[model samples]
Target: MGYLLAVAAAVLFGANGSVTKIMMEAGLSPAQVTQFRLLGTAIVAGLVLVVVDRAAFRLPRRQWPVMIVLGIVGVAVLQATYAAAVQRLPVGIALLLEYTAVLMVALVAFFFFKEQVKTRLWVAIALVLVGLAVVARVWSSELDALGVVLAIGAAVCLAAYFLIGERQVAKTSALAVSFWTMTIATVFWSFVSGWWELDASVFTQPVDIGGVGGELVVPMLLPLLWNVVLGTFAPFLLSLAALRFLPATAAGIVASSEVIFAFAVAWLWLGETLDVVQIVGAAVVLAGVILAQTARAGKVVDADLALTTGPITTVRDTAVP
Candidate 1:
């Protein structure tokens, strides 16, 4: 059940990349796209929390600072960077870069946290480095410089999201955690998202939902609605539910399938294609993700806790209490 839920979430998240790109091409800035996503997630999560657990609405004072960081950096900034990367880069390539967070979490656990990592972790590191080189074709230096940088930025934020969320979920429910963090992100982005300046007419304009050169036209608002509901909220809940049945390590490995799904979806929907060499590189990177998932020891601090965001990578909490 856990594996199924995780994979389901990955499928939605993977498809969401192209959906997000479509919205941006329709004239919405990355920040505006992020604003809509975050705000919608917050509202939906808040409503669910109200009926399921109203007590989650009241967070302790000591939790405020950490929640703020998670909301602004992990949720808000991470989504913004990812949105921008998708706009400037192929959806598959952008997602491959962001998924580096899986390796980042493993390395942080080994070095800073002094966790007992498996010998295979070193092998995993080598595979990821080599695979990324092949995928990038760094010899050519053809991809946009800024797009690569933005994707890397998203990786950093995602790493923080996993590390911090591991602890937060031990103390609170996942729905509550999402609600608070997304609420913070929505509030933070509201001031600078430039949403007010967006002309209402843009939403009414026709957009090509078919990225494969077909003329499947729809109002821009349709995809935007899909982005907020099916793309973001639905997947997030599935990931969180998966944690209930699967150990963190197993969940992380299954969630890593998102990269594969992302590449496949983008190719079919947006016509993003990769060379033979790059395809092999992607396979190698996926093998590394499998190794990295098992690198760190699995310790369930709280059996009831389900710690994950939309992207369901897991990390051991190394912070001294």
Candidate 2:
């Protein structure tokens, strides 16, 4: 059930790229879409929390600082940057770059946090870097430089999202954490996106509902609602539910499958297909991601053991004492 939930979440997240791109092509800026998506999701999640767990509304004052940072940097920045990258780059390529957050988290743990990690992490990092080069086809100069940069920025923010979220969840329910995070993100984006400047009638406008070559058309509000409901809220809740039964390591690896799903969905829906070499590169990068997930699991176990057992000591002067 946990595995199924995780895969379901990945499917939703993977499908979101094409949906977002469709909206972008129909006359919405990435920022506007992001603002609406966050605000809608926050409202829905907040309502759910009110009915299901009213106590979640009572957040501790101490959590405000980190939660604010998570809202601004992790949620708002990450989503906007990813949306921008998707608009500029192929959805699959943008997602591939953003998923490098797993690698980023491993490196940060080792260096900044001074955590003990297995040597395999370095090998994993190397594999991902090589795979990225192959995917980018560096010699061909086909990829957009700005898109790649934004994707990398998204990766950094994603790493921070997971790190901060792990801490936040330790002290609160995942539902509560998600609600507050989305609320904060909504507020932040509302100010930055200048959402008030958007015309209200735009939501009722007929827009293209598919990719560049697509023929389907729908009201703009439909896909926007889908973005909020299926793309963000539903998948997020599923992911949190999956963590209840799956180990973090297993869940992380399963979650990484979002890249494959994204590529597949884009290929089918948007007619964006990668070359054989890029496909192989994506596979290699996923392999490295799995390896890094294992290393992270080991690091967590090591930390737990150290905390529980303490440092080893010898009884050298216990003869007469």
Candidate 3:
């Protein structure tokens, strides 16, 4: 059950890339889509906490600053940059770039935190760098410079999420941490999302569903709901549930499959295809990520993994990809 739940959550998160791309292509800016996603997830998570365990809301005053930083930097900036990267890059490539956060985390732990790291860390970094070059096809200039930059930026923020969340989880329940972080993210986005500039009718507008031929059309609200509920909220809860049985390291490995799922979904849904070289590059990068995961075996907390994982979930145990 734990394995199944983890895989299910990974699939939802993987599918989110294509879903996000569809919304962006349909005329929503990355910021707007991110705002809606965080807001909806926040409301749903808040309601769940309210009904299931209202005591989860009673956070200590000392934790408020950490929650705010997590909301603004970890949730808000990380997601918005990822959305922006998806708009400018292929879904798979964008996810691949984000997955580098695992490498970044390992490096940060070794250098900044002074955690004891294995020699494999250096090899993992090298593999990822080479893989990124191949995936981007640096020789041909196939990747967008801005998109790559944003994706890398997302990785940096995701690294911070992992580092900070690791500590935060030590002090609170995973559900509480997720809820509060999302609440803060919602508040932060609400101020800068330019909600006042958005036309109300846009939500009712019919837009292309963005598949192979771009023939399907649906109300904008459908995908938005899907993004919030299935993409973000459901997967998050599923990941948390998985932790009841799976260890953090095992769950993290399973969650890493999200990158592969994202690639497959994008290819099937968005008609995005990568060349043989890029595919090999992606495989290499994933290998490096797995290697990094092994380097810090049993060191990562389940709650931290949940919050920092691929796309969404309170106890999400994502790849931070």
Judged by lDDT, which candidate is best? 3
Query: Can you write out model 1's per-residue Cα lDDT over 1-321, one digit (the tens) per residue?
Result: 877888888898788899999888877899999988888878888889889999999899988988888888888888899999999988878888887776787788778879888898899899989988888888997778899899999988887777776766556666788788889989999999998997888778898888886869999889888887888778777766776777666666676777788889999998989999988988888788678767777632221121123322233433212
lDDT of 3 by residue, 177-258 (tens): 6778777887888888887798878789897885886588889999999998888888878877777878767777788888
Ranking by lDDT: 3, 1, 2
Q: Estimate each model's TM-score.
A: 0.91, 0.89, 0.92
Query: Model 3 off-target regions past 4 Å?
Result: 301-321
> Superposing all C-alpha atoms, what RMSD in Å does each candidate have to the true structure?
4.0, 8.6, 3.4
Write down the lDDT of every candidate, Cα atoms only. Answer: 0.78, 0.74, 0.80
Which residue pairs clash in candidate 2?
none
Candidate 2, residues 237-289, lDDT tens digits: the string is 77656667766665666777778888988888888888999899888887877
**Rank order by TM-score, top first?**
3, 1, 2
Residue 99 deviation, candidate 1, in Å?
A: 1.1
Which candidate ranks first by TM-score, i.e. highest?
3
TM-score of 1: 0.91
Q: How does model 1 fare in lDDT?
A: 0.78
